[model samples]
Target: MKITTIGLGYIGLPTSIMFATSNHQVLGVDANANVIDTLNNGYIHIEEEGLQKLYNNALKAQNFKASLTPDYSDAFIIAVPTPNNDDAQKSCDLSYVKSAVRSILPYLQAGNLVIIESTIAPRTTEDVISPMIEATGFTIGEDIYLAHCPERVLPGNIAYELVHNPRIIGGVTEACTKAVKELYLTLVKGELIESSASEAELSKLMENTFRDVNIALANELAKIGTDLNINALKVIEMANRHPRVNLHAPGPGVGGHCLAVDPYFVAAASPHLSPLIQTARKINTSMPAFVVNSVERLMASAPNKKITVFGLTYKGNIDDTRESPAKEISLMLQHAGFDVTEYDPHANKNEIMIEQACEDSSLLLVLTDHSEFTTIPETATDRMSRAHILDTKMIVKNCGDNVKLLNLGNMHQSLNKIVQEV
Candidate 1:
């Protein structure tokens, strides 16, 4: 199949490469000429595990090619960015989607399948995208096909997840769904569920919203545990043993592109309709402020303290900082009149203000559970003036009795209680 993928960023490039490597002719279209040139040379702009190998092989095989302009193809996949607007509203910002649809309309012909792999609000496929294409005098489902197939790949493990994760295909019509499903069957090993375009859009939103709400519950419980002078970490651990009760760990804040933003799309579409989802978003969004307050309290305990924040990425093992809670916390601390330094092994040195080494600091805050941060020795802690620690992800287990460890999550309370009792 000849596939034309629009917007070759994080999602587009990987998906295009996957199809190309699978022996499909893929023409990747991006507005940026440099990105197209880079891909044509078998180079990737974004960092992901094992992407370079697939890109090189696909380029060598001549199955993958990139262009600055859209062209005619059997299938048109829209994988552009659908970021929320400044009002915290979930608007599709359809400019990019519209532009892509317009650009391809001139080249679109009958029997062409148009699949949207970008994360968007429900009804976008039917109400927004389909109409834009139909304006070109091409009938959908008969002359052309339209479907919504949201991408579920993680940034660090995108290459693997692109092929491993289950996919949801929501079509304008049943035939459209089957056509998109067959195309996905070429690369995806996971099951493909079919639904209406709106249902599939809501399904992706629900998946990420569920995670945000659960993590918010953990964060809210951690605050309660802190107020009661109990360890939140150990409490969560005990709660999880109940088998039916599973809780996500609390962090500095909800970060990254999806979980932090997607819920707002649903909430924005129906404000005063989804209270729990809105509340969860509020809780997660306020976590940076919570971490800032905690840091202020720590600084108050030790006058004129120099604080070091470990990790800037949203999660462990990834260099992405698109809405990193750790980075926000660091910035908030600096704004609060405290000396703040940051260190993330995955991040470029220019991205962080502090030196890579964890020396000459009064306190260390472990925001992300990066492997390098988890394995830091007591000797490194010894180098600091004060060994006060804030383990946001609760990755560190033991750090002796002298270290003032602050953990996020209710499970930490029980563990701290046990330590104090000993």
Candidate 2:
């Protein structure tokens, strides 16, 4: 089967390559000419585990090609971005998704399956996409099958999760669901659960919102623990020992496109009914300031205000920095009159090396839990004015006796020590 996937981004590129390598002809369409040119030359613009090699194999099979425009194919997958609006409600913006669908309208044929893999607001398939396609003189379920299949994969392990994760396919009609299911069965090893399009849309948003709320609880616990002279991480470790209680770890703040943004979509859909979600978002969003205050407290114990940040990506071992807390923390620190330098080994062309960033710095702030951050270079610590570290993600290790470690669990102790000295 010939497939056309629009928006050759993190998800679209991998899905296109998977289909191409699986013996289906694929045409990847992106608005960026640079991305198209890069892929045509057998180079991917994004980094994922084992994607480059798979892309090369797909190129060798002569099954996949990328272009600036769409082509006629048996299936069309719209995997474009759905960013949040600038309004107070922060609703999901469907401009890119709508544009991608409109681009394929001219090439769409009867019996062609259209799949929306982008995360969207509920009833988008029925209200927005159906009306658009119906205007083109084709019945949605009868002429062109439509389904909402949101992407559920991690960044570092996207290539593996894309194939192994359980998938949800919600269609306009029952026939539409089955038609799209056959295409996914080629690659998805996990169970394919079918439902209405609205169900799938809400399911995806809730999955991320659930994590956001739980993380907010953990962050709240951290604040309370600090007030009562207790360790939040230790509390979580003990609480999670119960068979049914599973708590998420608190960090500087929630980041990435999904967890930090999806809850707002739900809140926008129904402002009054989603107070818990709204409150959770408020808590998570305020974390950067909390971290900034923590930095100031840590700095009180240090000899100087020069601070070096370890990681910037939303999570560990990836190049994506969309809505990263590290960026927010760095900005807040600078605005508060502290000289800050960030260093991430996984980041593309980091501004400075670890040793250089640590030069004359008094505090080392570890934001993202990259494995490389587990062990700091002994030489890097030699340059610090005062060797003190704050591990927000709680993954740092292998520091000698000279370097003092501070984390969520022991921050109260550090604060108490500072008071005693005063």
Candidate 3:
């Protein structure tokens, strides 16, 4: 089957690649000419494990191509971004999604399937999108099979998860659900659960919101532990021994397109009923400031105000920095009159030379938990002028006896010792 996937972004590109490898002809459409050019030249613009090789497979099979506009196909997948609107309620902005559907209207035909894979506010498929297609002189369920099929996959392992992860197919009508399920069976090895379109939308948002709220709890625990001079990580480790207690780890802040943005979509739908989610967002958003304040306390008596930040992406091993707290913290630190050097190995053109980044720096700050950050090079630790580190991600264990190691578990103890004999 010939498939057209609009918006060749992180999700769209991968989904397109998967379809291409699954014996389906695919046309990836994006607004960016650079992305289209890159894909046409047998290259990808985003970072993901094993995506490039799979894209290579698609190119070899002669099954996939990218373009600046849509094409006539058996199925149209709208995987565009649904960013938050700048309103007081911070509702989901469907401009990109709407534009994508409109672009494919000229190519629409009877019996073709339309799938919305972007995370959206609940009822969007039934209310917002259904009307747009209906206006084009096609009944949603009868003429064009419409469904919401949200992608549930991780960044680093997206290609693997694409095949293994369970997919939720929520259609406007029961016939719509069956049509989408038959199409996606080519790629998904995991179960395909069926539901209404709005149910699928809310399910995707809630999946991320659940993580956001649990992370907020963990962040609150970190703050309480620091104030009380207790180890939050230790508490979490012990508490999680209970079968029902599965606590998340706190970070500089929540980032990425999903976790940080999806909760607002949910809360926006019903502001009064989503106090817990709103409060969780507040706690997660304030974490960058908390990290900056902790840095100020630790660096109060340092000889220099130079800090080397190890990572920038929301999580590790990806080039995505959509709403990164590292960027926010870097700005705050610079505004506060501190010299900051950022070294993101994944995003940067150069490789990670930890010793080079730490040279002449007052302290090293590890933000993301990339696998390469598990142990610092011995030379890197010796190069720090103050020989101190504050690993907010808690990925590093020991930076040797000469360098002071401060994690979320022990920042309080060192904060008390102002004149830390570095």
Query: What ranges in model 3 sit over 4 Å off?
Result: 419-422
Worst 10 residues of 1 by lDDT: 349-358
Residue 98 miss distance in model 1 (angstroms): 1.8
Q: What alpha-carbon RMSD in Å does predicted model 1 have with respect to the real structure?
A: 3.5
- Please state every model's RMSD to the true fold in angstroms: 3.5, 1.1, 1.6
Ten residues in a row with the worst lDDT in model 2? 345-354
Model 1 regions more than 4 Å off: 88-90, 349-356, 397-403, 409-422
lDDT of each: 0.83, 0.92, 0.93
Write down the worst ten-residue block by lDDT for model 3: 413-422
Model 3, 1-422: lDDT tens digits are 99999999999999999999999999999999999999999999999989999999999999999999898999999999999999987899999999999999999999999999999999999999999999989998899999999999999999989899999999999999999999999999999999999999999999999999999999999999998989999999999999999999988999999999999999999999999999999999999999999999888888899999988888998999899998889889999999998888887867667778888888888889888788888788788889988999989875787888888878889876764554
The top-ranked prediction according to lDDT is 3
Tens-digit lDDT string for candidate 1 (295-401) = 66555546346888888888888778888888888888888777777778777645533333456777788988877765557766776777778788878776666
Quote model 3's TM-score. 0.98
